[model samples]
Target: MALDKHSDTFSLQRRNQNGSTAPLTNWGFRNETDPLTDVLLGSPAHLFHRATSSLSRKHLREAPCNIQVAQAQHAELVSTYKHFNVNVHMLEPEPELTMQVYSRDSSVMTPYGAFITAMSQWWRRGENYAAIRAYEKLGIPIYDMVTAGTFEGGDFNVIEEGCVLIGCGDARTNEPGARQVAGWFEAEGWEVRLAFIDEYYVHIDLMVVPIAEKLTAVCLACTEPGIVEWLEAKGHEIIDVPFPQTMALGCNLMSLGNDKVIAPTSSTYLIDQLRARGFEVAAVETAEISKTGGGIHCMAQALRRGD
Candidate 1:
């Protein structure tokens, strides 16, 4: 069954001191594993596009996607979200923007609001505007916009309410942008962990994902040793996803609260690991979509995490 276009049912309402409804400043996400009540899934209308970066070229191998199959895969994702009782919203498609389907790269959701990213790739820069429009439509306030340097939302992962891990590598999220965002978190008394990864890894999310409270999936081979150690020391259960599977985006899974997750079908190892650890796994075949340079986590951006 086709999912209906996103309704206003998920719109948040909060009362100000004056007894009038106002948008909450802390409306977005504080933790990735909280009850995922709302999310923004990117549109797949222009998914088939020319490769803009090495990651895209490597994953796509310069091959074209089967548009029909890609759309079908995306629908499965939406269906899974609905089945899990998650409110799904779609980014209004921009026919001219080919890479707009990866909504996670355009902006990041924070406890305060959404921070729009400064896209590194010229071809993907237009996606920021599309994301801003979508957020406005959803009544999600814009917390801040990145202006210091290039940054993508894929590099951010919230560990808990007061702790976050940000990836900093010149290839995607440069130091300036990472520092700017870090400052905001620090001012709020949050501990910000910086993971400096190799350029080969497009984002930290490609190597790390929080599956549940005190549990995380990590590509140990690629993720920095210090970062892994810090997580372990923080009492997180480390589920190590091997290099081969990680390269296929096995670590790029989304936590849908209640110990459930949505992952790519091809991520057999990670899916099995998650299930073995008692997580409900909702798998979708994203072969065609992944070829466009991202996996499930990279395709959807969390909007509201809790009730």
Candidate 2:
């Protein structure tokens, strides 16, 4: 798949005409736990507090998010990424896209290319189009777009190089959408597992996220036993994050590879565990912005990792 950087003639679907799609030479990554070289982030300048989920709704009922504080927290997060020597790319902010701060929900970066997701919320649907524009500006070719049904990028969990654990939360990512994505990877000869979760969880990353090559952080209290067993069968060391912390988006963290991670400060359990293990953890405060619905990982989209 050759991407024309000088013009807007890049292919919309970069997947091979044949079953095996070749990985992009200059972009994309084989796995999540690779030294991150580039990341895509959205500006919190237009961020607004809305009832995007049960958690956000509760926060709104209790105390709405402080917009100024949220923007400052986002700046701190950007600084953390810069401190780690990772290149950060920001999406053009649109005033109407209040939830655009969560960049991970618009599209997913994979070895093949960017997979544009279908936004479940009416207000967020513009994000899909915005994602395409962002990719174009970055000179990244899109592998494909989800059309079977609604599927957000948060539900697309790439567990390893070729294996993926897709989440199907009826409200956000429906069964049809999950299977559609599963079928694409199946054709590419990758292992695909579908985990059906409750709507309240919003996304799979809320309860399960990969920490390293063979380490995963999971909320055992909420994750299904079968999923846990499957991970264990694959020799993955599970670090069980407590239920309360998980609800606070403790498990939703970004693995920068090379034993480094970016996590939310409120997730003390996960931060402590990572620190004890000698992992260089950049704990950024996200409590204010998270009230608008998303954490650290939700705010980023890995563009390139490990050459």
Top of the candidates by TM-score? 2
- Model 1 earns a TM-score of 0.89
Clashing pairs in 2: none
Top model number, lDDT: 2
Which pairs of residues clash in candidate 1, taking residues 3 or more apart in a chain or in different chains? none
**lDDT value, residue 70 of candidate 2:** 96
Mark the 10 consecutive residues where model 1 has the least summed lDDT: 12-21
- Against the correct fold, how does model 2 do in TM-score? 0.96
- Candidate 1's displacement at residue 213, Å, is 0.4
lDDT of 1 by residue, 1-307 (tens): 6321122222222211122222244457668998899899888887765565566677557576678888998888889999999889889898778888888999887766677899998888999988888888887766668889999999888887779999987788999999987876676677999888877788989999999999999988988888988999999999898898888778889899888899988889889988888888998888787777788999989988874
lDDT (0 to 1) per candidate? 0.81, 0.90
For candidate 1, the per-residue lDDT at 220 reads 89
